[model samples]
Target: MNPRSTATAHVDTFARDRLPPPDQWPDLRFDLPELRYPDRLNAAAELLEGGAGRPVFRTPSGDVWSYGELRARVDRLAHLLTRDLGVVPGNRVLLRGPTTPWLAACWLAVLKAGAIAVTVLAQQRPSELSRMCEIARVRHALCDIRCVDDLAEAGVPGLRITTYGGDGPDDLLRRPAPSTPYPAVDTAADDVALIAFTSGTTGRPKGCAHLHRDVLAIADTFSRHVLRPRADDLFAGSPPLGFTFGLGGLVIFPMRAGACSLLLERAGPRELLPAIAEHRVSVLFTAPTAYRAMLAAPGTYDLSSLRRCVSAGENLPAATWRAWYERTGLRLINGIGATELLHIFVSAADEQIRPGTTGVPVPGWQAEVQDAHGRPVPDGEPGLLAVRGPVGCRYLDDPRQREYVRGGWNITGDLYVRDPDGWFRYVARADDMIVSAGYNIAGPEVEEALLRHPDVVEAAVVGRPDARRGQVVVAFAVLKEGAERDAEALRAFVRAELAPYKCPREIVFRTALPRTATGKLQRFRLPGDGYAESSAREDAGSPTGRETGGDRQ
Candidate 1:
């Protein structure tokens, strides 16, 4: 099916018209029969109707909704959107809320009505929300009553907002809705379905536009091939629905496989560990930090039901991976994905996993280690990682699109090495490499060594300005409770672990590390102080270190 030749169902052509010029777009390939979607398709209907009568979402309080029930809710919301709110096809609708059934229903409703979904984290400040609304040109919003304050205060001109999950007369759930099924919009398969912005903390956000076909392609490729699930699998995770990783893992992947997912609104490791045990979740998805935190309190969780675990949103340190496997006997499936490509593109199944390396590309995807000039580098040479598949990067009216997609491949800003065995090993982010005395040192390598230390729970290494050495390695470490705060001792430990030149010249002790909403470490946010106030508390012989909640998904 020639996607470009089909007539769009959108009444508003703003989104499609603003896409990067066709010449700059990466090569889009439908490499599998399953990826060849119909010309006229609504991704929500395709995902929901296939699993009718099957359990789809489960709440922590024992509440459950089957596929049929969720579909009816979504249909009602879709009908209300077009009928009452005057929403038309291609209208951008903002969705903000915690991870709940209502939030999921709102997302599907927007897609079902052929309206573009603009999902944002509930934690965003009013200023941030305002900036996002301006960037996407979003006016209509479906905000949870708890989150309405920020959206309303964002002051988006003429925003028609409908509050849900409230008892008020104007609340969306309070409105009388028809129970009959509403026909899903007949949108072109290439029509944009949702715009997922980056989860970084600083700078203006970059919105990644994804098509309706991409929503389903991720499930067909990664979910079906790498993390194969049975119909009875009970999934659970800590990521918010706003993040693409969570949207796929907690919702799309589970629904595509006819499995039920337990949605936790407060899903830190403390909350998620018990939820997995209470709900008997068979499949778990979270960042490497959450996995390590769970490993910290191992005996308390009855993790007998967990058979498959996935780690992403940050690099999975080999020491953390090995510790989890040794404790739970489940190998962490480490994968690298981006908001640009949608979901996990490179990952391995249970036995296919290599301990320290992100595995080969998934079926229907091609990846390579490329140098600065976009040419492929020899195996084992560190270079920029470039990949392309059914789903590729499409930024929403941002000039960075030209930089992200180059020469028919999405040049993910990750530094990687393709070993002779064809597995891709993560080095560090391209910008995270430090040049110390003409030797290139990857920060994650130093962090990985620090994580292997018994007392260190979390570590982040960055390049600090050093006039003599060009740039010196600096590490911020969060130690376990009661562990000694001896920076020199830790520096010596890394010297013994790796080459002495790679060792951090200074170690700063902190109670907690700064992270973005999706739990990725914001290395730029690290403070310049040699030691934080927590170190002063340690000097006074007082306990320091804060409890790590759930990581961003």
Candidate 2:
């Protein structure tokens, strides 16, 4: 099972060698025979080559790019990458750009040229990009013209960079290519296609290596069985293309079904509502926080065209789910996915929807709640959530791989409780659980209780060290406009819904809670001196300061 055997002849073998030991990897299961891919597979060939004349992408400004047009553009870009830039199969090409038709073209071109696509978020600072360059040993970058300066600031030695968009002479979009169409390379299904970095909650981000087959496996399992997108359905979302959530929702899922995807450069809740109405977007992918924000301006936009609304990135509280359903009569599709698994493994569609629970495992995967001894916990008990599917974690050269994969399952870091009927209820992250006076307190459970208060706009619960107790549950909350900030009253509100031990010992009022770009809460920033510093930073510039709804997973 040497990973190197499947790598293309032209790629750098460093990544292949860095994969987790064969024993540590989970057994990939493709229950559906069609999920079994060929020995030599090029993902771009499947994503871009098959669709002939259907509309593929549309910009916010109303420009449309059909499948035929996008295919020609991708072929030309692939030719330029191989012929002009000497990019051979297996070389890692960094792709940095906002969500746009050209950015999609660049990504597919890199894969079509038989190179691994390393997608970096456009908002990432130089320091972050510099660290990625070091870890992946990336040497070439295809970036937006605006990000060219940041790439230079990274100061990676011998790093070659190309720019797209803008009126520059050497713009990647305007570069000429040889007339010949560059056929997709024949890469092994197991050959690495992308190196998606995890959100650095602890320390440096770890790169997750995904194979050519893994890309389509997610589409087949989650998209095919659960979401069930149609060719005429228009997909849109707020997630940046760099996020696996966005990669699946905005690009891969749509292309897999020959559906059209609307590309919006700035897709916050405010922007997304109008785009959904104007473009008649059918399937929506976003976090719970965005769904909460959009609930504010009810009846402001025509969202009748939206049939399916998917929520992930964090836990979806039952309150938010109820509020959204009450407002639009559309049940929110709640699922939990991680960077390692590629996309949602557990989810229920329209009729099977459950408000608070994160549904059963998708058709191609198996899940269970495990205790510290690596044994399954009884129903109604909380423990680690472990899953095995066609796609799982393969951290590139990281020792933490041993901690993530145990036995034959990928142990997702979240803590959960499984009911007798097998629905998984999220409690908190393994690290976010507060051990106070020997009582286990799930922070999200307390946060959900606080969110039930009409005056509470947003809330984040964390464990603050206490002298009498090892740690006490403390909450930072943002109140609605003109609402009084009475800590005792808020504490009483929470006590009414939860046990006294689970209620927050103290409530701190804040303009906003710190969250990541993808909208996940930053629990680590809540305790100790970090609280004051984060509060000050939020007060100074966080946009969510005036807005309700904190980011979710």
Top candidate on lDDT is 1
Q: Please provide, for model 1 over 1-553, each residue's C-alpha lDDT reduced to its tens digit, 9 standing for 90 to 100.
A: 3336578999998888888878778988788899888888899988886467888999988888999899999999998999899999999999999999889999999999999999899998887788888888998999999999989998999899899999999899888888899899999999999988874334567788899999999999999999998899999988889889899999899988888989888888889888988889999888888888888864677888999998998899989888998888998888888888989889997878988899999998999999999999999899998999999888889888888888999988888999999999999888778998899999999999999899999998888777788888888888998899898888889999999999987787878877655567766566432333332232221222221211122
The global Cα lDDT (0 to 1) of model 2 is 0.84
Error of 1 at 163 (Å): 0.6
- Candidate 2 lDDT over 221-292, as tens digits, reads 889999999999999998888998999999999999999999999988889999998889999999888888
Clash counts per candidate, in order, are 3, 3
Quantify all predictions' global Cα lDDT against the true fold: 0.86, 0.84
Worst 10 residues of 1 by lDDT: 543-552
Worst 10 residues of 2 by lDDT: 543-552
Instruction: Give the Å error, residue 270, model 1.
Output: 0.2
